[model samples]
Target: MNDEKIVQRAIEGDDTAFLNLIQLYKIDLYKTGYSFLKNEEDVLEAIQEVTYRAYKNIRNVREASYFKTWLIRIMINYCNDQLKKKNRVVLGEEVLNFQGSADNYFAMEIQEAMLTLDDRSREILTLKYFHDLKIKDIADSMKRPEGTVKTWLNKALKSLREKLEEKGGKVNV
Candidate 1:
């Protein structure tokens, strides 16, 4: 179903519809939260709060077609609020011990390198890479101009490449 239909169902107190929407976006939301807080527990809490707030204030959301962006904005705000409440602590390096595949190693390394970036850079990378958002969508989600998003994206990629290169791994654009 279209997001508007789903949201319309949800607005009428359809818990199932709301839950379905949450399920659809939960992983993406959690990963975005994790990118910011780098804590599984904090990510979970933020996701929970985002869902509650979305449900409680569903009436305030003006348009259903914009639900995904609206939800992401809510998640970002919740994560930021949580960060303010408790300053972020650096997370330990992600372990690649689960699978010895080269892809796993590279993913862990990238995650570690991403951790080193400033929050905005990290978020841009996460939105672009992990969430698979288009540059335009990312700009809208971030409330930044398209040109600014492009600039930040280029700078962020360069920063990440340098960091990876220093670790003896190169990021080829």
Candidate 2:
């Protein structure tokens, strides 16, 4: 079934539909959680918490079309709360462990540069690039104006470029 249909079913208190919905997005949720939390255990914990919260509050989601965005917002908020509790700051070498092919290494280098940014900048970059979310969806998920989201996205790209240049990497942007 389509996500919207499944979401509608879930909102109607179909336990199986909710479980199916969670299963469908499990990998995305795991990856999103892992981006904030490098540890496997913590990522798993965040996913579990997000799942429970989403299931309990499924009815609160107004639009079935935005189910994924709503779930991601919850996960992001949960991850932020976890970060606050641990007072964790994502350092380059600690978070981006680059061990693989040369292409993967370069990608990891960019990720390391991204780690230098503030949480909000990193988040916008992730949503735009990694998750491939459009500006409108990002703005909605963040509860910010589209213009604000655009400004933040530009700032994030600029900051990423600066960081990359500082590390002697050539940044086109």
- Candidate closest to the true structure, highest TM-score: 2
Q: Tell me which residue pairs clash in candidate 2.
A: none
- What is every candidate's alpha-carbon RMSD to the true fold? 3.1, 2.7
Residue 108's lDDT in candidate 2: 64
Query: How close is every model to the real structure, measured as TM-score?
Result: 0.76, 0.85
lDDT for each residue of candidate 1 in 1-173, tens digit (9 for 90 to 100):
78789888887888999999999889879878887677787788889889999999877666676677778778877766676676654553356234678887777677778867776787788778877778888887677899999999999999999988998965685
Pairs of residues at least 3 apart in sequence or in different chains that clash in candidate 1: none
Q: Lowest summed lDDT over 10 consecutive residues: which window, candidate 2?
A: 89-98
Stretches > 4 Å off in candidate 1: 9-16, 35-39, 80-101
Alpha-carbon runs more than 4 Å astray in model 2: 90-101
Put down candidate 2 lDDT per residue, 47-83, tens digits, no spaces: 9999999998999998898898888878878877887
